[model samples]
Target: MSDVAEPAPSLARLGYSERWKALFAPMADDDFVPGRVMRIDRGIATVGTGAAVVAAEPAAHLVKTTGIGSRFAVGDWVALAMPETHERAIIEAILPRTSAFVRRQPGERETGQVVAANTDTIFIVQALAPRGPNLRRLERELVIAWDGGATPVVVLTKADLVSAADADAMREAVGAIAHGVDIQVVSGHTGQNISALRSYAEDDATIALFGASGVGKSTLVNRLVGADVQATREIRDSDGRGRHATVVREMIFLPDSGVIIDTPGMRALALWDADDGVSAAFPDIEEFAHACQFRDCTHTAEPGCAVLAAAETGELTDERLDSYQRLRKELEVSSARQNDKLRAEKKREDKIFSKAARRYWQSHPGQGGRD
Candidate 1:
């Protein structure tokens, strides 16, 4: 007789939806077990297998080959291998991710970093206190989120600190920038309009909160969990910047709904590879591009360029167009570098194969003797 083991409580509690079931179908025949990564630090990660959360390390082969890109993050769905010894768990593979939030790390290194994976929605939180709201920063965040394959929702926190009229005005201003995306005003201190935000927390869904420092992201997270899971800190009065409140990216599962991943607030948001997002965020510019005389109009000095014409006529702000162009140029440069690396790799592989073929011929001279 075969032994039937009890299913993990956490996976059962999360409920097996058709979508998740489909996602798991590919792994059912494999020897690995499925789990959701809850936290990651150094080179290790804690994954929840519905039964229990366990600390694990990526298989040595995977790590020695690809470095950190293939390693686990907070929200990745990974496959685990349990050895006879219970102490050391091995993450053999990662399930295909539906969505991932990636950004360029702000440093001298020129590499993109994956902030969170498999997020269904991203709450781009911004504060209405102290210096009011930063529309430019919000616009940049929206572009990145949209490019990351997640729906972006603008959350204006700290409603209690601002006057009702001021809050309404801020909402309107944000609405103008967001276009059709949803915007919610909530007070983390007073617990206002949190119910509206709860709808996105449906079963099997995952949401991530991202924004600048002192934006009340941690406070909002505490309200949602119904406990102070995250620490709250005040912004410095002089510079209007706050200390890093949430240091690590961690996933917290809601009681009846889904999970939320909270990460430390970011200071610099450099564009990575968000051309599609730029187009979607600035639809007006995209629309004008279609009317250009040449199909591939650079829109800089080309004749009959509708985009540049729109900027000259004040239909589109030059500053907005400039920002769009700057991002596009960055994407082009990054793509070129990536393509060059790929070509170089292909050339090296070809050379190695030719060398191997020559060596094989030399070893078996009787099979095909030289003239």
Candidate 2:
């Protein structure tokens, strides 16, 4: 027999860090495979393992025990089991996530949706063409991104369409609202200032692009990837909305740097679990809150409330406080609704299990079954 060892390309190219290794050590053995989820279509996920990109279905036990609604999304790191029959690879288990981007769907029904998982940074893109800019929407996106535990970088696209002075003014206006976030103005057509945006993506990091429709998110993704990975379209003359160019969340690896996930443009980004993000995004208001006489000051009508005092002294804008209070109340209501839904779902599942047990006992007449 030849004395040569085959290269373990999969393990070698995984390039997991010490932190990731420790995170996975408790859940994975030495022989367990590691991969990053690149795309999720329907229920099947395409994972990038070092050996090759493989299509996989989550294990049946994982599917049954964990709600599919809350499990494995695009950009998740997962553990894989060797294929038994050389036909299908099984996603044995999902490694714990470092961060996830989640939002509540806009509708009568109360439901939370996970947009992406394990993202390191989020690029909040907004177009400066057609209309100047939607400051309110930009603020909302910032809050959601901050809450997701990722650094939010604002990308103001369509700079070539506007005059130089107009672009500077728009950037200044956005910078005022953005507070401490980094903002870049780039034109996909002219390739202006694209390098500033590229500097964020380094090795072993993942960045996600999020923006409203017609904001040139897909176009920017195409430019960054240096190829037509996503479809692009022009916005309507009447409104700033463009056609839904990207329908799914997919991850693409850069030539030299890390991965980027492009998502469908969101029209409504309702907040879900964003209390910390709200505080971080509105640091001015938070700083004022610390000076309040009472620790629990609502800042609405309380005397000695530093927030109201700031607004009166022109240190804080009334609009800013109003937006902050509105988002806080929305988060409160959404959290309560989510808890209620979870309780209701649990009760429903319990009832179904009880009924099934009764039916089984009736059929067998002497069988003892427990859930």
Q: Write the per-residue lDDT of candidate 2 for residues 205-263, one digit (tens) a residue.
A: 78899988778888887788799878877545567654687888888766567678999
In the predicted model 2, the residue pairs found to clash are none
lDDT of 2 at 255: 56
lDDT of each: 0.79, 0.80
| Per-candidate clashes, comma-separated | 1, 0
Native-to-model Cα distance after best TM-score fit, residue 49 in candidate 1, in Å = 0.8
Q: What TM-scores do the predictions have?
A: 0.85, 0.85
Q: Which regions of candidate 2 deviate over 4 angstroms?
A: 1-15, 65-70, 106-109, 234-238, 342-371
Candidate 2: residue 363 Cα off by (Å): 19
Clashing pairs in 1: 11-50
